[model samples]
Target: MVIAIGFEGSANKLGIGIVDTKTNTILSNCRRTYVTPPGEGFLPRETAQHHKSKVLEVLKEALAEAKLSQDDIDVICYTKGPGMGGPLQVVAIVARTLALLWNKPIVGVNHCIGHIEMGRNVTKCENPTVLYVSGGNTQVIAYSRQRYRIFGETIDIAVGNCLDRFARVLKLSNDPSPGYNIEQMAKKGTKLMSIPYCVKGMDVSLSGILSYIESRAPGWLDQGECTPEDLCFSLQETVFAMLVETTERAMAHTGSNEVLIVGGVGCNLRLQEMMRLMCDERGATLYATDERYCIDNGAMIAVAGALEFETGQSTKLEDTFVTQRYRTDEVFISWRT
Candidate 1:
């Protein structure tokens, strides 16, 4: 059995997974959310420190659950970039150290590529336009010419970040993620308050909506006019609609009949429904992965690393630096034959 260990410390979550690459099966996976107190924005150094403290614990748990020894693992894999520098450094240090100690080959996989790979694995779609939405990113992409091309993306704040900001504005619970809480509240509300929907040539602007909602919250609460649920529902509707529009446009432009939604935001059932409805109207298929693969996890990293390894992609020690803004197109395909 070809065993590969994957590590992910891209955001507030630290994830580790063991996989049997020969069988394309996930042997074990474990994740732990880093604690970020309210009122403070995401701090790269603090986030990395959190990862440093918890990564070993999570990795050990995953290994124990998989019933595998460290020697059983043949290779190490990790997310390389498009994330906070401090958090990325924590994972990179661990991966590089492990690679040196174990005398194993290391692959640095792109985080966005991992998302797309996991989506493809779950959906089994050969050629599908992907809608990748999350706390740090929002993009409409498609695979072409041996690379995933970004057709449309957010120009300002990411959809999840916008939601989280709004959640903070409303003093919503941060536990279980602010986005998930908003989703739950949206399900409870009925009144649909109108919100601005901005989409410009496949690009989206979320900061405006976030600001608008924050400005309107006091009047709505003081008048006891609209419930929080209604606000959540309207916010979701406006944001998700823009995402759907960009994705549909990408599909039309690329001539892809299938649409696959990936990333943390994709876990929202309401968003899934909106995409599904759009796909149905267009006579196209829509695919979404479960929470395990949708959220940032080690399994996807392992899977993507396996693909890169098979294609002969390996990272050099000197070239192994963390990037806070790594783009998907910047990666060279060393594995594709």
Candidate 2:
């Protein structure tokens, strides 16, 4: 059995997970998210500090839960980017330190692949049109030619960031997550107000929607024209509909019968419902994992890294650098071959 430990803290949440590849079991997974006050988002610097302070404690907890010592682990894995620079570095540095200390080979896994692999593993979907959405990324991906090809994606700000910023505008609580609060508030909405529906083919642009909503919100509330629930409900309806539309397009174009949604935003129940309806209409299946696997967690990184490690993909100590612009298609998927 191949046992690997994964460290993931690309953004606000710091997670540690242990996976056993032989049985496809996530032995241990623990996460701690750094939330900012209302009307604010987590900063890259302080978020890094939070990870640095808590990384060791989380790792210890995971190891205990997994009932494994450092000697039982075969590999060390860390998310190698397309995330906040500061937060990414802390995880990478910790991974590097642990790799050296334990004398384990380190594998740098793509954050996007982490989500995709975990989703596929949990859902038992062999091949599907993947809609990956998160704070930093939004992409419609399909595995073709041994690559997770990007068919469509956000051109500007990510969908989750747009939601978080809108939540800030509404002064929603960020205790658990801004998106969750927005989703809850949206449930209270009676009317679905109008919002700009901008879908340039499969690619989406959320920044414009965010800006327009921000501009009109104060005025609308002052005029007693709309409630915060209305705005939240409308925003969710519009954006999620856009996402479902693009995902369905990808499924149709690829002739894929299964649609897998991954990333932090994948935990939204309303989004899941919308996607499910679209899939049912098309006679395709919608596959998604629960928040434990859907939200940014170490299990994803461990699973993806374990696959790469089996194929002899190991990152040298000097090559363990993280970057904010690593595209999903850059990493060659050798396991597929």
Evaluated with TM-score, which candidate comes out highest?
Answer: 2
- Candidate 1 C-alpha lDDT tens digits along 206-310: 998889989998799789989988899899999999999999999889888999999999999999999999999999999998888899999888888877887
Best by lDDT: 2
lDDT of each: 0.87, 0.93
TM-score of 1: 0.96
Model 1 residue runs over 4 Å out of place are: 37-41, 333-337
Off by over 4 Å in 2: none
- Please give, for residues 1-337, the per-residue lDDT of candidate 2 as tens digits: 5899999999999999999999889999999999899999999999999999999999999999999999999999999998999999999999999898888999999999999999999999989999998888999999998899999999999999999999999999998999999999999987777789989998999999999999999999999888999899999999999999999888889999999999989999999999999999999999988889988999889999999999888998999999998999998998885
| C-alpha TM-score for every candidate | 0.96, 0.99
Q: Where does candidate 1 clash, by residue pair?
A: 311-335
Lowest summed-lDDT stretch of 10 residues in model 1?
Answer: 34-43
